[model samples]
Target chain A: MSQADDLIHQPLRLKIMAALAAEKGAPLDFPRLKAITQATDGNLGSHLTTLEKAGYVAIEKDFVGKRPRTRAALTPLGRKAFRDHVAYLRAVVEAAEAL
Target chain B: MMSVSEHEARGALAEIEAVTRRGQTLKGYRYAGPILMVWGVIWFLGYLGMARLSPALWGWMWLALDGVGFAATLLLAAKAPAAAGGAAGQAMRTSLGMAAGVAFVLAIVAVFPKHDLLPYLALPGLFVGFIYTVLGIYLAPRYAWIGVTLFVATLAGYYAWPAHLAEWLAVVGGGGLFLSGVWLRSA
Candidate 1:
């Protein structure tokens, strides 16, 4: 399977993507993403890189004058992948609930 | 730089990428407006709690509850993902640490009263509140109203509850603030 395909199976990564996707506007930075996912840097970044390299998310770089900065946004592919993952997770949750 | 784990390195990349988009994450969270919900609630609960509770004792109980709430906020904040400590984060973090430090000093100072030293408590107390208010209001908008609400709530509690019962209001008020802060900001 492709990287995106592999990604949807991981619960924490799925949650991170879902949170970012749910946001409006550009993208999320490390701290905001950390707050939403409640994941440490190592865990979230490992997942983010996997998505980034797969071309599922894009990273931007620049500054507010002198201040350094970074951000992450889901690519179209990433968004779709996340939705699919959510649906899959929902189905699993529903199935469990039914059982 | 060297201490970063692999995961942190990635987080740094993600955050560096964010700088181009807009304000850093701190500004984004401030504007996100979810925290505003917490802002409104924390104040409202404080208002109600004070209306319900008393004076002198309300001070102590609320003080304890606030102590606990502050601790919990720090704990939750610690759980937050490690973004590379940038200017904003470093400043915010330093100010927060100093604010806590001042409070600790005041807590100790509060117990020690000298005719000459007694006046010194005000310096630390005001200093702690000032740092707190500046962070909540100026830097961290998400939690901006927390300090103000807390201050107002205490005033209200001082007037409302009995001295003995005010302590309970502190516990209840802190719980109210925490729940509302999370619900409104996160939910």
Candidate 2:
């Protein structure tokens, strides 16, 4: 049985992980993540920081021309965790359906 | 480990699926933007040539411009990362679709050889619009918007200003595509 990841279980955080995982390692910019998650800057930033601290996401800040851009990508561990979480969710649904 | 109710789990999974799909569509748009822009420029040039140059020169001009567009598309595809999920397969499918579209257009022209220049000019744009609309419906809503806009504009220009249809296509059809490409790239 797959185990649920508490840190990734939050609705917004799960959305963040899903978006990053979909990129297959390519970094997505902060604005793109904000769009996908539909979260405010502070909320998204805070969740990203949490994922960063948990070693599940890597955040990079860089300058493009004069503009500062922040991008996030799923770490290998994070990708595995996301897959496991998804599997757990599916298992839960399946178990319920089987009942 | 965290405990999630079946309802919560199902909802979370649904959200994840939606986000993942949106991410993939955005990524597809990013990859396709430059290619569309390249075609936009080609259309601009080709229509401009048709408007300005002799009727005999239009064919050669378009052929050359199309060659450039195809080469540019290939180069861009080559530069894109190979690991970007199904990049190669997508390219192959797109290439085949493009070729089939071209062949279908040619066959139509051959079968109906008596058509006026207006129909000939309108055919490509209409076909392109149809393709974009259908693909957009499946892939992204923005594409469908662009496609619909192109389709309506092409017909409007055909009826409203038949004399300057080529120039109108150059500006509206070509320019619309270029602008949409820029917009998609920013997404």
Candidate 3:
């Protein structure tokens, strides 16, 4: 069976990745992502940093007027990895069913 | 390899899809309510001017009023928080398409001079309705009914009361848009 993406295997990270990947070209602002994952600021920040370190997600920090804004987007690599992980999960489910 | 039971794997997949869908759903339609409501009011006021004043003069007056409304909408949008960004590109594309549509309609109207101005009046409502429908389908599903309502009301007005086309567009179409804004604001 294909291996799952370890970084995306965690529930919160998986949710974050799924949200970012869904929009493709559209970068999601930090508050919107937080609302989707229901994660606190610190927790979400750390996971996003981890994904950034892995090159799976790119975080852009900029200002909309005087206010600071942080937008998160799934990298091409991250999108591919997410698809692969989902495929691997499906394979595991199918294998178990066959057995 | 992360080993997991079939149930666990399936659950994770479902969870991911759910999160993705939630992310895609619109979260800030209220931000658009003020713009819609303001435009609707301007349309109604234009209708009144057209009824009381001459069509040639009122048309220019209405255009000026619409320009003000456009500026107001821009200010309102700028002041409102930005929760979404993808819709900006989509809106620009739709506006460009609608402008082309308006140009086509104007060209046709100019070529075939009809004594009845119903077609000219009806054309703008149709254009606005088309934009609303497109935006509703692509950005906000809640606006779908509003779009349909605008189309139906304007078209029906064209057929039923040709002379009162402006009235119908203002009372029914504009009113609907304003009400939609209220619904969005409260939603």
Question: Interface RMSD in Å per candidate, to 1 decimal?
Answer: 14.0, 1.2, 3.1
Tens digits of per-residue lDDT, candidate 2, B12-100, equal: 99999899787766766777778778888988998988899987787678778877877887777676676565654555556567668
TM-score of 3: 0.58
Please tell me what DockQ candidate 2 reaches.
Answer: 0.80
- Per residue, candidate 3 scores C-alpha lDDT tens digits across B75-106 of 66666434455444333343355446646765
Pairs in clash, predicted candidate 2? none
Candidate 3 stretches greater than 4 Å from native: A1-99, B1-24, B87-111
Ranking by lDDT: 2, 3, 1
True contacts kept of 3: 0.71
Error of 2 at B160 (Å): 1.1
Question: Which candidate wins on TM-score?
Answer: 2
TM of each candidate vs. truth: 0.39, 0.92, 0.58
Q: Pick the candidate with the highest lDDT.
A: 2
Off by over 4 Å in 2: none
Error of 3 at B54 (Å): 0.5
> What does the TM-score come to for chain B in model 3?
0.76
For all candidates in order, the CA lDDT equals: 0.51, 0.86, 0.76
Lowest lDDT 10-residue stretch of candidate 2 chain B: B86-95
Question: How are the candidates ranked when ordered by DockQ, highest leading?
Answer: 2, 3, 1
Show the lowest summed lDDT stretch of 10 residues, model 3 chain B: B86-95
